[model samples]
Target: MVPTYLERFGDSVKFELKVSLPQNTLPKNTVYELIPSFRYGSQVYAFDKKLGFSSDSIGPYVSPQTKASFSMPYRDGMEKGRLMAYGQLTHQKTGKSLKTGEEVLAEGIITTSELSQIGQYYIDESIPVMGLSVKYGDQDAYGMYKDGWTELQRLFMAYSNLGFAEKSEYMKVIEGRGDFSHKNLLFMELKDYDKVRKDVLPRFDRLAAVSMATTEKSEMEIALLSRQIRKGEISAALLNEAELAAAVDLEPGLGEKEVLLKRMCEVHPSAFSFNNLGVVYLNLANRSLDRTEKNRLLASASEAFDQSNGFFENPYAAYNIGLVYWMMGDKASAYNAFYRAMAITRLDELRKVHEAALGAVSIYNGDYRLAVIHLNKAEKNEINLFNQGLANLLAEDYYNALIQFEESAILDISNGYPFYGMALIAARNGEEIILYENLSKAVSRSAYLRKRAPLDMEFIRYHDKVGFKDAIR
Candidate 1:
């Protein structure tokens, strides 16, 4: 027997068995039957029988050795088992059979193939936004209120993987970047706010009332809370108490924005107004703690997006609907919405949205080839590159997946997902030290991944190893 141990690849465990039969070891009139099996505890799994050479059968034998190979589907509890072979010799003339003792062949198995990750389609939540022309640092060009602009900026920066402290620190950096001075002059260009104040506001007193109702936040508390909500560290309902009350004190004006947008929709249900309203509900859902409340908000947002789409073929509205569906775990509906967005526009800037959704959805569907094709078409980024690596991993292309993960790590060192992907590759290759190194680095960077490592089956073989436990801790 070669290797003395078996290795598992994907769902199967395979090994080679070489048997040597010395010349004249068996009588010419005798025949041999060999049975290969795996034994664990009291259970035995047997393979198909193979017949050995017999001179009486008129078979020409050049060599006195028999080389055979076996592959069987892997099962649980087989990891701690041993391989065994049994033989029987039958006399041709006398019709007598002699049973041979069980022979231990090799010990198995190394189950490192369980580390491959299942890929999923995700709506690129970062790209979709409310309002028309609400580009970063250029919210004024779209006639959005300053409070709404601030909320939108925070919404874009929110990351579920980040902790509250990290999120708050990033928010400070954003506020310090520039004092929104350049955007102010651009804001004045919005149909000449001077004209809106003297002509429109005076004509419609209700518009003045709505403008007064717009809430302002001196601090970006909702940004921190949004990160917590996304992380599941805290829920929107819990923030109502005094201890964390400051976080949702003003509700980040999401409520106010909803009220104002609803009033605006009653008077003028334009595509832009309805789309912005949908955006408001989406944010509200992000902050919601209760599953039912979140689902309701997502449904409301989807309906608003549908209304926006009916008024005009708005790509943003389509993309937003896709995001809502994704959050709601409706993969089929999300794919359709994302596909619709791509159909509405082929602009290179929006390629990320289309490629990511389509590729990830393909992965979720177990179509690795299609997922790779879509991912390959997308521009490189931490998110898409990581998904590309995941797609390749699922396709059993470890080499390409490792390359993609390495590239993704280079793009964003702080991102734990790329490191986690590399750790999975290391585990699959049975590189224990490398696995521990990468796993340690990964879990150290993201609290989310730290919690996932112990439960992940990829490292099941090393669960008892000290290095594995320490790395996850």
Candidate 2:
């Protein structure tokens, strides 16, 4: 029979204290609460000492169907689904640790009282252990799980045989023989890593994608937060799996870009939101035709990027802000933005983008020499090569300019910019036939270039020519 005092305390005989979750959200790798014995002695409690269960609390939210997918905040990197839980067992009134039996730990992180400690009474816990003599079935879990149905059936049977007092992690806190409310604080790692990945994660990813795509705003957030927990850079496979259930794009359906981003920001305030919001705004700006609206979108993009900088000093965000300035035709601001990004960015790949942006801004600013220097530093690519040629042409370096344009042409046969560069060179040398041939090819490929050619100063001499009018038309 349980004592009246123990009944009133919900048999909190084991619980010295329990920490409430912050905003009802589970945190990873945090020491939630200390569990000191309320009674000072070498006695081991059943729930506390033997099994590690405490009083009633909400079990972590898990999927009702699969029981795998849950609201666990995907911890970054190696911390995903793993933690080193630490705790100490101290006396209730003596204020000293009880070093009894063998000090054990979930991962040896807890300062368990050992043989070395003075004035520490070892509390012996009587617990049964079970192990299979032959290690059961196939040692290679992957090969065994390939026969998944059979393997899981055998595994479940094995688990049932291994018992802990006919009671599961569920413990109710009532006065009589039972408690109405129950809770489970224990978590387990999947023993067969490859097996779980092959069988479980795909289903979870499918759910993640569906939740993210649906009109339901609340579920969409949890799905995105789950995305942030990948140990490595997210693979296309996982994203593809998630997209299978989506009928429409997640971004537009949510709401206006700013409103959607703000809601996301409130739910999950991470660099992921800040960076992606900048991108969405930048894309919106590009799509808008009205100049004032475009500028307004660019301003929003810049602000999103600026907010991202508050989370982390990222060159990706910096370059995006620079791009917004460039599109708005603010050459000085664009170059300064790129230069600032370039100075702080240690990654060569990101630095290349910053350098190329600075080069393009220099071309527009009429700083041909600076443009050449910046363009040369950029990674060799069709776009950068074409821009380099443009800068060289402005500086009257036709030989270097032609070489750059020809290389750009070879890299991307479909792009018309390189041919346009060659036409400019021919126009400078008074080669009308050669100039008109290249100009025709350039105009046929690019609508914008075709529209601009007739009014271009470089093509002024050819504007009156029949071939030029034909190409422009």
Candidate 3:
């Protein structure tokens, strides 16, 4: 049987059954009869077609083989059903029954196609929490801080260029704050300055509201948004860039979002905009099929991510750059980017963990034991668990690999990679039947594995086996 299990395509469940008769099984005047049927629960449905063979159908010395195919209408009850074939030997002349036997051809039906239209979606929820801190520091060991030196320099220049009308009072307040240490600088709220001095400059208005402070800080070090202003008007370019970025954040289609984000960059380039642009390009590249177009998009994505990394050191851009470099076939660069991503810290814990796993895998190269340690840090989701299983399998820890694979399969029943991992372990252990069983389940859930099984070197020993070929088919 080509699929030792049934598979449903569209509205039909289809399968093939192969029956072989030994030489001389059918007497010269006798006919061997075969009947096929499906059984689900208490219901039994027989196939409309019947198969029969006689001595005249086979040559004198050779065994006879035949293949029967069925495309049965799929029903909900048949999901857990079995196909059975019954054999009978009868006298051809009088049609008298002589011997009878029954066997199960295939067990159960895989209806993974039923879940084809399923998709993932998320609900928007608002949560009140502390936002980015006002503190600026150059000791960005984890790459979390923005460029404090650049902002501080701009702040000093802004104060240096202030007009004489309000310069004296502003200087008085600034001088009263003591030394403005670069490492412990703070960006003071313009509203707070308005309380201290009545005639505060209108140019000092903040583009965004400052979140309520949850901790008290020393007033010795302060910076202001007035650094961004010029000639009595707020920075219109910055305002335009912010509006465009907000539109981009609304997540238009990739093409539209790419255009808007590029415009935002042209208006006022920033790490955030470049990183998001890289993500859009990466997505476009992934969805494109033409090799030339895909290469072009990947190159652009790589460039955008590199620009983002140059502007600001962050894990998202590093991880994205790794992905783009990986797709570009630059394995060394990809490994370096992954390493950087692993070293960087971010508020998004899961993304950081995923990047760490990728980094550890790349850093260790083929040292899968160390990779498993890093992968274990990830949450026990299907992808993470499957990766853990793969790492263990490569490390030659078949016992743990099997456990992880099983756990992954249990978590996501429709996922084929876990079963495929189990199949690999079975092949390593020389368990041919177990390999076929798991491989069958794997191919049932994944069309890619169905095409890959025959060509995969892991199954080389079974390449010539009929069962392996049938399973792959």
Candidate 4:
């Protein structure tokens, strides 16, 4: 009879060998010899000790019970190989040996190569594998050989057997000759076009036919692909493709300023975007160099600001509109915008606007004392120090402006504007030693300030002084 063998536990195997004796035969000292062997790949091993049995029974009685066990050593790269056990039983009494059918117990095949590749891939992607079983199958076979084989098969199916499902998912995000419009819409919303195009799209294209034929598609796989795409580390072509899938709707003959503002409002309706749209319009108006374009851009800017106010209560929006009105020489509207901004948020920034407004009103109404009072109050706020100094200079309060500029420079030494203002004050006061020091510092801080000094109101008088231009140069 053949040996009945079974794997009893992890790293150990159990087998029960049964041998038959001749009928009506008996020996005073009947001895049975048993040898066990196992083969794996090109390597084979025999148990070091021979299994021995002796019995006095006759007439087909079972021989003395004997059990044998052999340990299987852990081997790398042996997962794909098969293990077999073979043995023979011999009777010592008559020197007869019977080759009990070579019991060949086949072990499950292990895909070590595939498992190593997957492990390396996970490492490259910075994924942690702690606590998770490395082998295939459930927790019951966590460290068992069968579990490892099972895991290998599962991974193989994902990469090969279900290739078609993966390909369809990839094409859905890349807009490549497929109905990927809805996927593209989702991609655009998630800002994940680039990743889908670079990684998923290309990988699928390479294995397109295989993926299309796959039958084991899974929602988890699709979700994982989407997450990887949104990480934004992928290519820009993917983003462009997604954008193409979700094409923008545009109207004919729309002004550039109008179009930009409308798109900003529709695509990004945040307070920051609205305020930025207003600034864009204001910039275009300033650079138009044509009265018609300037009026058009300013009108567009005003409309954007109005739209911004509806979405967000921001002081900067009102303040920016006021600046546009002031540029258009509309004093009443400019003042109204400025006052509205100031009321919305009592930001010290509005004090500078109020100072400028009061200075203009005082000069027009011939109320210098009121203008000085407003400017003095504005000068007290750290936010308005720069503008306050400039206002004092305009009011011909040169000494006071110098003091204010000096204080402002001390507060923010990196501000080249204040440094240049200090240089101007020093030169105007004929403090040549201080002038040289301040100008040198200003030039060191900013090359632009040094180059523009010659064209400045305060520095123009001393532009030709010896070594002054050379120092700036």
Candidate 5:
């Protein structure tokens, strides 16, 4: 590793480092960020216990640099030391992340689960950590600072996803004892900021607070309201839409959602929040463990969705309304909701969500043909394939269902539903041997399927068969 050169300009100090790396270390024509994690105080300057990361920039000749300025230790009496800036660089490829210039052995690399197990070794809680190797051609990185309230990797993803205002809001909240804009952040390239963010932004783990309506409520206010909600002092009337949404997630259990969300939609009346409220009620109904309360909670959920569609022509709200109605056993009403959802023009971000939702509701409403249409609109994946199989099965297109289920099973061998569908499809066609094989595979993966098989209507024709009994046994 080459030494990082330091220079002082006014109150801030700037430094740069250049280093060698493997041939073709970074793909050409792509942008990458040089993220630096910093530590302050005299204790760390002499030596710090945390494992440090040091790297020399690879191809395209990285000239990573940064600047820092620190005030005197304390405002009142005295603290320990002035702030310090530091960085660690790493390279990730095909599920391996190694320190700078460390060769990730081409074979028998660590699995994702193993890396997480390795992460368990981090007991310091104070030191930040890092992650995954994107598939080839997606080697991109962006800069983010980690500190209290935002050290989690998900926060970085949220920063990438947010608009300028939202990103600034997050930086303002988490930049404890520091400022970000003045920092001379270095990236390997200056391209794909928007594209990279778009590709990675809508990942499954979105930061709830960052994603919510923060323009109205600051992070501190939401934090305070969340504390009150957790402590059983949920004053729904006092919290705004964002706080109420956060409360929906923070509330210990199902009890507060009924009150909190109802009040939330009453005051704020956003289509999105109401759509979430519908989901919350659906969850409460699902978790009640009492069949008698299911219809009532579902009805309340449907009402919440009714209010949502009143606010905006939202496909998600309409789709959710359809889902609750179907659960309520009102098939015609569910169909109407699905109809409205499919008719509306959805936003780019919601197009796939809307397609997935409509496809699911179509199956519930017994519109198998419609289900197939909507499922086709969605991007093909294990879930959609399984849903398509369901649609085909119910529509009595046994051959098509068999093909979809077989494909879905290959995608997720451990998911019992696809195998279960295959078994039922084989039963419909009187392919006795195939039926027994898939039935055994399904029950082996999930014990619940073993119980459901005996009572399942689709398998009724072959229930008494000796093979069926033996497979479940």
Candidate 6:
């Protein structure tokens, strides 16, 4: 007779067994018997009448264990969401049986959304696993296996979703002195800053106050919030009041705060706090009305920039110093600083510095060809088109200059420099219609640019012209 067969369906198995009786049975006491057996990997399971009554048990007993056959159905192998096994039925007395074919079933292909859901399920399941493992296992073993796995999965999933480095960063949180829960919560909010600001910022402000009741908790919260701001997720304005309050809470006076900031720069040179202090000095220089104060602040800015360079050769620091020198009218020093910044960084802002410095140097040195070369390179960056237009004006290339200026003005409607350059170019070329239109636009765009036009050497020829003066004003 043919052997029995089993079919597998998603974590369950069903099998059919066939049993045949002996050709002759002598007496009523003769045993008619069969035992169902299953094999999965190396483990074997059997169903027999002697083992005790089971719902899956089959066959009848008789005086003698006769050669008989019977069919039995079974549901077995219930772990790991998979089933792989074969089945058979044998005579207990004869120890002989018919074979069944192997059957297997498995799960494959999981979507990202499904994986996320599965991860959540695993996290939830881990709580029960932790309870069970703690109850059964020793403390150290439970910590290493069950609780560790749960924590690892939670942290890894959290970090991965937030685009953070995913290589077991949970250990850092565990080992660190600060509150990891608050840190993780802040990280989640920072991952979607606009969403958080819209939905959670107000709540966060209230929570921040509660956090600040303790020094250690307050410092950790501030540090995490600062990281988000530095990453450009949260606006600086959003934290302005909070930061001021914290500063006042921690230290009494603004002067003392400045001193502490300086000390912070010294202690954590590689931190962005040092670069930010340089920015503060640069901002002060920009606002100073007294030439002496402006010069002193600019010098202070340069010192801060130098300090920043000691920790990290940040290009923006070098570029800001270059800007300070340019504002101080030290053209040579400005160009050298810009060149150094350009050499150190390939950032687009540094490219603008290179172009602006090159344009200024070329114009001062009377090398219009070099000015054009540098301006053209700058224009390629797309960000420095207005400066390129100004450089072209200095180079006396009116037609190309007008084109560059027009393109730049189109990109930023409020940019008046390009309009001013175009106006001057048009007036010098005796294009009265174009000159009046562009000059009017320039004056409309920027009152400051219009006021400064008389002092601008690039428009010197048109500055005294009655038509140009009337049109610009």
| Cα-based TM-score, every candidate | 0.51, 0.47, 0.51, 0.36, 0.49, 0.44
- Sort the candidates on lDDT, descending order: 1, 3, 5, 2, 6, 4
Look at candidate 3 and give me any clashing residue pairs: none
- Model 4, span 177-241: residue lDDT tens: 11122233444454344654554444543442232112132445433333333343443232221
Model 2 gets an lDDT of: 0.48
Comparing 3 with 5 on lDDT, the higher-scoring candidate is: 3
lDDT of 3 by residue, 207-226 (tens): 11221112132222111111
Model 3 misses residue 462 by how many Å?
1.7
How far residue 453's Cα lies from its native spot in candidate 2, in Å, is 1.3
Would you give me the overall lDDT of model 6?
0.47
Tens-place lDDT digits, model 5, residues 91-180: 433333334432211111111010010110111222222111111111111111011123333544454545665555434423321112
> Which residue runs of candidate 4 sit more than 4 Å off their true CA positions?
1-276, 283-297, 308-316, 326-336, 343-372, 375-383, 443-448
Lowest summed lDDT across 10 adjacent residues in model 1 is found at 133-142
Q: Put down candidate 6 lDDT per residue, 237-262, tens digits, no spaces.
A: 43333352243235433344444445
TM-score, model 4 to reference:
0.36
lDDT per model vs. reference = 0.63, 0.48, 0.59, 0.46, 0.51, 0.47
Error of 2 at 344 (Å): 1.0
Residue 188 CA displacement from its true place in model 1, Å: 37
Judging by TM-score, tell me the better candidate of 3 and 5.
3
> RMSD of each candidate?
16.1, 34.0, 19.9, 39.5, 30.2, 34.0
Q: After superposition, how far is residue 229 of candidate 3 from its true place, in Å?
A: 25
Candidate 4 worst ten-residue window by lDDT: 112-121
Q: For candidate 2, which ten residues in a row score worst on lDDT?
A: 111-120
Please give the lDDT score at residue 441 for candidate 2: 88
Instruction: Point out the higher-scoring one by TM-score: 1 or 5.
Output: 1
Enumerate clash totals for all models, in the order shown.
2, 4, 0, 5, 0, 8
